[model samples]
Target: MRTGKPSKTAIKVSSSIVTLGTTSYGQQILPDGLVDASEKILLASGVVSEKGVRWIKSPRMVSVYRAFDWLLPGQFEALGERKAFFERQVRAGIAAGATQILVLGAGFDTLGWRLATEFPKVKFFEIDHPVTANVKAKAVSKLGRRGNLYLIAEELGKRKLPDVLATHGSWNRESRSVILAEGLLMYLPAQAVRELFGQCLAIAGAESRVVFSYIPAGPDGRLDAGRWTGLMLWLQKVAGEPWLWSIEPQNIRSFLEGIGWKIAPELEGGTGRHSTEYFAVATNQA
Candidate 1:
C-alpha cells in the first residue's frame, strides 16, 4: 500500500478465496454461502471476464495454485482455516447479542456481505483503504446494496479509527459490536496497533468483542520461522506492505488488558515449530 494504490495482498487474497471456494479443500473449510458470496464478488469486480471466470474454475489453474502452495507450505490451508475460524467467531458474537459487525482493513473478504444477508437485523460495516475499498464498493454495488451493510473507505493507519468511523452516519457507537481485524495488525506499527484497539474500545459498547489475527514472534522474541521467515518478509516488502508488529503469545493478555480488553480463554498457538500465525478473541468488558 502506497497512498493511492490498492493493496496487492488484498487482490491476491480475493483470488485465493475464489480458488479455495471452487476447490474441494476449500469447500471443506469454508461455509457454502461464503464461497458463493465470494464467487459473486469475483465476477462483480470485473477483474475477469465471464468466460475467464469459467477459466478460473479449471483444474489447471487450481493445480497451479496448489503448486504455489507447495512453495509456500501450509499457506493455502492456513488461509482457508483462518477464514472459517473468523466466521465462527463472528457467528458466536452475533449469538452472544452483538448488534453490529465492524471489520477493520476488511480487504476483499465476503464475510460481511454474506453475514449481512444471513443476519439482516445486524448492521455490518467494513472499513478499508480508499483504493481497496473502492474496488470492493464497485463489486458490492453490482450485487445490490444491503441497507445494513456499510462500506467505508479510509486509510486506517493514517487516520484515527474513531474519527473515520464517526463520520459515517450509519455507524452506531452505542451498539454492541464484534470488531474484526483479520490479517491487519501485523501490517501496522506497534503504536498504531495500540491506538486501533483503544479506538475500537472507545467506539464499542460494553461487552463488545474483537477477533484478530497476527504473526507471533518466536521464542527468541523475533518474527523468525526458520527458512521461511526471510522469504515471507521479502514477499510482503516486495508488495510494499511489510510485517511490522507482533506480540508474544504469553504477553497478549497483559497487552490487551493495558488497552481495556481481556483475552478469551482459547488462545491460539504462537510462532512455534507447528505454527507461525496466531488468532485472538478479546472482549471489551469496559
Candidate 2:
C-alpha cells in the first residue's frame, strides 16, 4: 500500500520500451507498409547505432514488453483506435495548412518518421528519454529520410520536456499544428498531468490542436477498480507502473473544455476492446 517513486530499473521496464525489441503485438497491429518503411529509415540513419539495436534486442526488455502486450491486447485494441485518429488529425492539419507537430512521451513510436515522410511540409518534434531519442535519431538518419524531426532527450514527467521544446523553436501558431500525447496520461500523477497539460496549453496557440489518451475512472472514481482492475494490478506489479489516475469520460471532456480545448471524442463507450477508449484526439479551440 506504500506507493513510492519507482526505481530506475522499474522505469526502464516500461511496456513501450518492449515494443522496441519487435516482440510486442504492436508491430502486427501497425500497418506493414509503415513498419517496413520505419525499419529502413532507422537502418540507414547510422543513428541506429549499435547501442540502440542492443537495447531493442535485450531479452529482459523483450520479455517485459511481451508480458504487458499479452495482458493488455483487449485494452490495446481500444487504444489502437488512436492510430487512425492520428492519421485523420495529421491530414486535417495539413489540409488546414499547419506545419509543425509535437509528440509528447513518444516512446519507440514511428509516427514522427512516418508523418515526416508523408507530410514533407510539416516539422516533427519527438520528445522522449535521451537514450531512446538518440536511438531513434540514429535510425532516422540511417533511413536518409528528410524532414524536420527534432529529438528532445528528456523524461516526460521531468523538467526537460519544456526546455527541449523551447530550444527547438517556437510553435508556428498561425498554421495550427497538432500535439499528441498518446497512451501516456495514465502513467503520471494527477498533479504532474495537470502541470504538463498546463505547459502544453501555454505553448500551444488558439489555432493549435492537442490529442491524447486517458483511462476512465471506475464507477467509484478510484484507480483500477473496474472490470480490468485485476489485470491492471498484475501489470503494475510486474511492469512497475501503478495506475495513478483515472478520469471519467465526461470529466475528461470537461477538463479539456475548461482548458480552452475543443474535445473531439474519438474513443467512446470506454477503454475496452469494443470501446473506442484506445485513444482520442482533440484540438485547442482557443
Candidate 3:
C-alpha cells in the first residue's frame, strides 16, 4: 500500500461491492438496504464515482457484468456469497448471545454499520489498514455517529491482534465474539495467517466463532486460477496486493485444529460458493 493512500485492491473491491449491491443479480445474494448503505459509504469516501453508480443501476450494466463473469468465471458472485455468509454467521452469533463483533480487513463493507444500528447494544468493530480505515471513517462520520461501532486502523500483518486490540478500552477479550476475516488470508504470509487465527482464539471467549475465506490450491498445489489467471494476477500485482498463500481443502481441518479451532459442518462439502475460494466457519471450542 502507498503512503497516504489506501490499498488499490481495497478500493477496487469496494467498487465491486457497490456494483454487486446495485445490480439485480447482486440483490439476490445481498440485502438491498445494506447494499445501499455500503454504496453511500463508498460514494462519500470517493472510492466510487457517481457516474459509475448510474451505470451500475442502468440496464447496460448487465452487459458489463456478463462480460466480467464470462472472463472472471464466478469471481464477481463469489464476493456476494462471502458477504452473505459473513452476515449469516454474525447474525447467528449475535442471536446466540455473542456481544463483540470484529471485522478484519473490512475495507468499505457496511455490515458493521448496518448491524450496529439494528443491535445497538452489541459492540461492533472493524480493523483495517490505516489508509483504508481512515477514508472509511471519514465517510462514516458524515453519515452520523454509530456509538456502538468502532473503526480501528492498523496494518493487520505488522501487529499482533491481541496487542493492538488491547489498546482500545472498548475491546473486550473475555466476551463472546464473532471474528470475520474476509478476503484477507490470501494477502498475508503463511506465518501471519497462522498467527492471526491464534490471536483471534486468544482474544475470544468460549464458543466464539471465527468466519474467514481462503483460496484453495489445485491438484498441483498451485493457485487454481481461471483461464484469465495471468490477467488477474497482473491486476493484483499492479494494485500492490498480490496473492501470497493458499490452503488445500484437505488441510483445513488439521490446520484449524492446530490453531485451536474446530471447523463447522455447515459448508457444502466443506467448500464455499466459489470453486477456487472457500469460506470456513470455525469455533474456539473443541
lDDT of each: 0.80, 0.60, 0.82
Alpha-carbon runs more than 4 Å astray in model 3 = 267-271
RMSD of each: 2.5, 6.0, 1.9
- Report RMSD for candidate 2: 6.0
Kindly provide the TM-score of model 1 when superposed on the true structure, using C-alpha atoms: 0.91
Which of the two, 1 or 2, has more TM-score? Answer: 1
**Model 1 lDDT tens row, 1-286:** 5766767777666667777777778888887677667767867876556786676667877888777664466776677778877888888889989999999998888988888888999999999988888978999999988888999988887777778878887778889999999889989989999999999988998888999988777788877544578888888888899988887878889999998899886533332222456777899874
Q: What 10-residue stretch in candidate 2 is worst by lDDT? A: 1-10
lDDT by residue (tens digit), candidate 2, 89-149: 6667667766888887675566787777777768888786666566656766666656477
Q: Choose 1 or 3, whichever is better by lDDT.
A: 3
> Local error of candidate 1 at 182, Å?
0.8
TM-score each candidate. 0.91, 0.71, 0.93
Can you rank all candidates by lDDT, best first? Answer: 3, 1, 2
The pairs that clash in candidate 1 are none
The candidates, ranked best first by TM-score, are 3, 1, 2
- Candidate 3: count of backbone clashes, pairs at least 3 residues apart or interchain: 0
Model 1 weakest 10-residue run by lDDT? 267-276
